[model samples]
Target chain A: MVFNYPNGKKYIPAAKIEAAPKIKKQKNAAYSNRGMTLEEDLNDSNSFYLDRNIAVIHKKPTPVQIVNVDYPRRSAAVIKEAYFKQASTTDYNGVYKGKYIDFEAKETKFSTSFPLKNFHEHQIVHMKAVLEQGGICFVILRFSTEEEIYLLEASYLLSFWERMISGGRKSITKEEVIECGHKIPLGFHPRIDYIKVIDYLYKLS
Target chain B: MVFNYPNGKKYIPAAKIEAAPKIKKQKNAAYSNRGMTLEEDLNDSNSFYLDRNIAVIHKKPTPVQIVNVDYPRRSAAVIKEAYFKQASTTDYNGVYKGKYIDFEAKETKFSTSFPLKNFHEHQIVHMKAVLEQGGICFVILRFSTEEEIYLLEASYLLSFWERMISGGRKSITKEEVIECGHKIPLGFHPRIDYIKVIDYLYKLS
Candidate 1:
């Protein structure tokens, strides 16, 4: 059967059925076969934490600017028009054991260096503000090539940002990150397990 | 001489011209100057807090889903089609004095009672999650007629919400709010001095 989308695009179900097995095989051939993206994994981890009453961290929804809507029925309102808007804050924030935790997640394909452009100016400003208010702020950096991760504190990020502005370094080197940040081991159940890092940081602080 | 809008409507100048004093008096009488709405006042107060670095709170931008946008030459992007979307989180949150503060601001025109319908199930759920995570969560209630404002903690709101579900009070009475919530005195510097209430709650907790 064929299903037509709102944009008049023809969708074929039989073709998708035929491709599903091959797509699954290809996906298994890829790294780890974790069956999820970084976003999905983190979301699941957050849910696990919430269920256990360990912490309450949430990924903020994408901001969109809406201009029109149509209500065909009394109960259903369909969005007819909208556009993505720039987010003014970090992606994730919540309270963990009486301390505020705020952070952004980023993934990089490069094994040697992560590009600085992945972080926006507003995110930097937000991190700085959180730090000034004595909240624990950090960024979770994932090197997809190496399948490794690190949690870099916002203070270190601010220093790198200032250095970039002063023409010192265009981006933070992998060595520098390894030296300054905490290495987070990949886990089976919660995936990132960043709360462990938070615990460590809290104890250290 | 006259200027017309794109819709061919007569344009009214915001500035007052040197007309006859009698005509000016008549024009002033025609318009009811009720001053700023509660939302506007709160927005101004939030901006004041932001400027002073006392708090980092912001009203989440109206959610929108855009279908079309026009980028005119030498002009900003014009959203041609969009629709408002349901927000999954509360309207306002920030870090204040080493604490994570989250809240929703609501206004009621009713003099005697505040309607429970003003809040959504999703908002209540979100507030509950934040509260469970040890974040300071609350709601700001503004009574337009009385020009009174109250800051009610999430615990109180949840209690009232439970009563609503159990066939108890359908709405919170004005007197109940005045008794249970902290009365935020309108001030000159930051306007809504909610931090005072936060300090008190912090101490109690």
Candidate 2:
């Protein structure tokens, strides 16, 4: 008996691309001048960790609400109409050393403090859920101008967030973050290398 | 100073769908008669688990490579050209009771046996990685014709897959699955409560 898949490959409902257009590799002098964003650094670090068979963390794909699709002849299906959907959880999550690791990375251009406004209420609630489940949840805050990175635990952020909602400071002071969070020195190969900090924070637990 | 996001929200890159067209909730007689597909059942179960705060499992969004995006209005950005990219990991993964749970779900109409071809090599490799990290990894097989669902451990599937590649049976017999795999009974509320099986299997270990 032959079973036909009318909607070929139900697992991957997205359009398949054939003969991917070659990307022109033109180098720009200013390309290296632009520092890597927190996302890029974390992606590079995740790849590095993955390649070495160290962990299985991945950045969840951006959610898209597809409405209309066009299947061009002999080529990939083109998404003619789609909209982005809000993420219900943090950006990055995966398993490391038999423990679940989850985190969100955010960059702040502010010189003195990180604004709590940058994070959404839903994200804080999601982090709370992760913490309740015994998963390691944290936020990687990148002080872009200062080129400093810190890993702040979800518990620390939760208290401050609750305080803010209760008519407290709207932002987390730089001094408070420095006191509460762990500093992660930047590395060349893994870029952000947040796993080292994970090791420090969650290895015992 | 107030900083306004010209793109209302930068965190969620997807476009917001305002005044979404009515879904026209017409019930198709055939759709209801045809038992819920594996994907739908799992989605329902995940929602059930999430609503009760019992677990936080989610199906990863399909990955798409966006080529052209059109900002037709100030409020929404429309994806004009995008292609789906192949996934590197299993479909469903999340933390449950402090343990990392990862699994793939597939369905076959064959009543006698479950074919191994439904799974990809990369997915098997991914399950291996998850296992190595001490995470729970498995496959949920749905025999559509028989209306039976079985939860087979990654180790069991790996053994059968290796046997097939080494000049053995290309499929796992229904009897074998029944003997080696745990049967997951269908439910009304949670649909496919595979967590119940997980609790029975891994709660102690």
Which of the numbered candidates is closest to the native, going by highest TM-score? 2
**Distance from true location, Cα of B181 in model 2, Å:** 1.1
Task: For residues A11-106, write the lDDT of model 1, one tens digit per residue.
Answer: 324554343233223332334465566666687788788778888777765565433345677534444433345677888887776677889988
**Model no. 2, DockQ:** 0.31
Evaluate every candidate with DockQ and list the scores.
Answer: 0.19, 0.31
Quick one: best DockQ, which candidate?
2
Relative to the true structure, candidate 1 has a C-alpha RMSD (angstroms) of 9.5
B176 in model 1: Cα distance from truth in Å? 0.4
TM match of model 1 to true structure: 0.76
Candidate chain B TM-scores, in order: 0.78, 0.82
A1-205: candidate 2 lDDT, tens digit per residue: 0111222332322232222211211111222245445666788898888889788998887777665666665345666766666677888989988788889988777879999987988789889888887888999987766878899999999999999999999999999999999888989998888888888777642
Candidate 1 segments exceeding 4 Å error: A1-35, A71-75, B1-40, B61-86, B187-189, B203-205
* Cα TM-score per model: 0.76, 0.83
Highest-lDDT candidate: 2
